[model samples]
Target chain A: MHEASIAASLIEIVIDTAEKNKAEKVTKVFVKIGRLAAIEIDSLEFAYDAIKEEYEIIKDSEIIIEDVPITGKCQKCGVTDTYEEMFFACGACGAFEVELLTGEELTITEIEVD
Target chain B: MGMVDVKAKILEKNYSKAAVLRDKFKNTCVLNFVSSPGSGKTSILEKVLVMFKDKYKLAVVEGDQQTTNDADRIEATGVTAYQVNTGRACHLEATDVEKAMAELGYDLDLLIIENVGNLVCPSQFDLGEDAKVIVLSTTEGDDKPIKYPVMFRVGSSFIINKTDLLPYVEFDVDKCIGYAKGVNPELEVFQASCKTGEGLEEIAAYIEGMIAKKKNA
Candidate 1:
């Protein structure tokens, strides 16, 4: 669901940033997405390819997506820990009730243009 | 080939627009309603409109991806209701709501948008609502909060409808409260049935109270 939206936006952001930096073309786009960001990477790449086809600067662009783990705070023990979605429980007290913290990021980690 | 590593989230456009809408709603206090397909959201709205339409100046935006069924029901209450069909999207976006407001074509005291029948996609998209009320039924079961934690955690209020069917189905009211409290301790929960009119007064009173607070503020 998010792949199409994410890919379309990614291309726009890259082209905009590349223009701002006065670059002729963008070769690699590095994006850091969190575990709970709800994006499908494979579909995102496919959509990116389709969208980039019209962009002269990003026709051969490479997208490297990295997954950031999610952090949660336990209500029972006040323990803060990091875990994937499948293991979304308090690591210290084994409580299923936990407050999500910091795993919902969709950030542009870096941009390389030359 | 020259390489440009760009890192950014695509939802920045949608999320930021929602934030601006939230700030605007803080001054007016709009209540958003979300529920399953057959959970009686429009029926409850129709009943409430009957009792309070004369007491208040009301405008309603009915959000359905396909039809104007809910808006048609609210219109019979002698109130002007705008129907917004989201087309293929599962939920109403802040931009969609902004258009609905323009199409309403009048002054208003209270506006309610009954979102699409979904607990997932709708929860993620914000319509600049001051408070969100989620409707669940006795038939939907007690484990709803556990299964759909996203909606339960985000909603400001909960309406457990279909109280008249208590004898026919197995719904543990205590368990639903317990699970919801475990996730969000401050969530205000209410129980009512648009069918029997049981426990409906409390919700109507709550809505009136909220409207009064907004006007005073």
Candidate 2:
């Protein structure tokens, strides 16, 4: 449901990037999403499929989603590591006092265009 | 096909607009509150309005799916409140706040934007607030911070509302605070019961202190 809006924003960014480069058609869009960004990739792709037809340049464009793992630093032991679980505790020190270093990102890194 | 390395934030439009709004509010304290439906957000704001009405020029931007009831309630407090009906949209975006700010004018000592109910969507959008406050009621369970981690992680403060009902409910205050702190190490937690007026003074003082700090900075 909210993914539609996210997809709309993404399409707008891709269009702007495509136009700025004077590309005739957009083939693919590379997007990086962090684990904590709270975006569902499948829903976003569905939204893009429904909305991309509105823009001719990106009608056939493919969205490539790259998942960014959650990485953080422990405040107690000063250890930095990546965790697949949502607990996000310091793996070495087992402390919950940790600062998130990354994995909150939602960015478009590149675009493939003709 | 040719590839263009146009590395940019997907929500750049919103980011840039939020940046502009942040600059505009550099001297003012803007607080955005997120909560589940019927978590006492409007009621809290009404009490807050009464507490600070005589001290500062306060403005509120109320976001709801429909109706101006919240705005009307705020207006009854003698403070201007802008009602933003998002229609089908689930959350309030930075653009919505920008328009609301335009309607309310820029001269304000404190601005509070009460986000639409729904912890999931509002967490994804940044409305250029100085701090995001998450309000939780005791009846809602203590695992909310861990279940809805995004909202807790983004929020700078957590308000445990409806504390007057604590004796009736099985809400562990310590566990709730611990869960929230685990999500956000620097999160400021406050316990308040709007019905009994408990903790409202402290909340008001905290906000006033924030406003003073921003103005002095």
Candidate 3:
């Protein structure tokens, strides 16, 4: 799964930042993944747990994931709506020119450390 | 315990590597072809690539789980092809492309990467390609675009392959294009069939246009 690769990258970032901050151990890793990012949260957590075992700094860390809903603003009618489906058709104007406002994120906002 | 504000993308490492590759491929029009297994990605390449092999310096990086068959077929077309057997990996990462380029050298006008025959994972990994050309054959359901919207969203060009089978299959070309457009309105769509050689010239022209655009840039 691509989540395994994403988890490895997340671990790399966490270790790099923890070392730079002079932290002895990392306790929590916080990340935000959007609906449109196409990532499965359980798969990502499984991968994180599996990969974190190799690094002592993050071995005991727990990952906190915030799933973001896909939202878009209609480019034609200026209406904002949360998209449950993959289609981006505007809810108000029925235009396909809806500009995505969120739900494509794959960012780590913060981490807790000792 | 203190919270260290990292505020970074999870795949930042790959993105950074891809950025470097993008810079290195300034003169090379690199296109990553992605699709499900047996979507005729290599077939389209085997046919379309021969059209430009004599006119331009071209090389291919074939990604598969464990075979050199695709690479060998590409090489038979009189072009350089490097096979990257990803072992257990389902997709090719930017590091894989970098390693392939190390062996293939960077003296090419065009670099075609036939991604591991997967639609889901490959869309997430950027291989420093100018465009992600997605191939979908008629045998696959027309609703595949909506089913795999992320791939359609990231892809620049969409190819509906095996148009020769349209008369026999239940695939609806218009509905498929509509679904793809619903996800990405900017996608350039094309219908192609390798067997009858229908709609291949336009695909070749589109690739040539990309090569020219990269060279002029």
Go through the candidates in order and give each one's DockQ.
0.40, 0.73, 0.88
- lDDT digits (tens) for residues A1-114 of candidate 3: 789888988999999999999999999999999988879999999999999999999999999999999999999989999999988889888999989999999999999999
Q: What residue pairs clash in candidate 2, if any at all?
A: none
TM-score of 2: 0.96
Off by over 4 Å in 3: none
Q: Write the per-residue lDDT of candidate 1 for residues B1-217, one digit (tens) a residue.
A: 4554544565566667767766655545578999878898988888876778798778888888898888889998887889999887677878788888777733566778899888766766667777889999999999887667667767888989999998999999999887776555668999999888987888888888888898787
For each candidate in turn, the TM-score is: 0.82, 0.96, 0.98
lDDT of 2 by residue, A7-112 (tens): 9998998898899999999999999988888888898889989999999999999999998899999989999999776566689988988888889988888999
**DockQ of predicted model 1:** 0.40
Pick the winner on DockQ between candidates 1 and 2. Answer: 2
Lowest lDDT 10-mer window, candidate 3 chain B? B118-127
On the 0 to 100 scale, the lDDT of residue A79 in model 3 is 93
Q: What is the lDDT of residue B20 in candidate 3?
A: 97
Q: Model 2 in CAPRI terms: which quality?
A: medium
Candidate 1 global TM-score? 0.82
* Candidate number achieving the greatest DockQ relative to the actual structure: 3
CAPRI tier for the interface of model 3? high
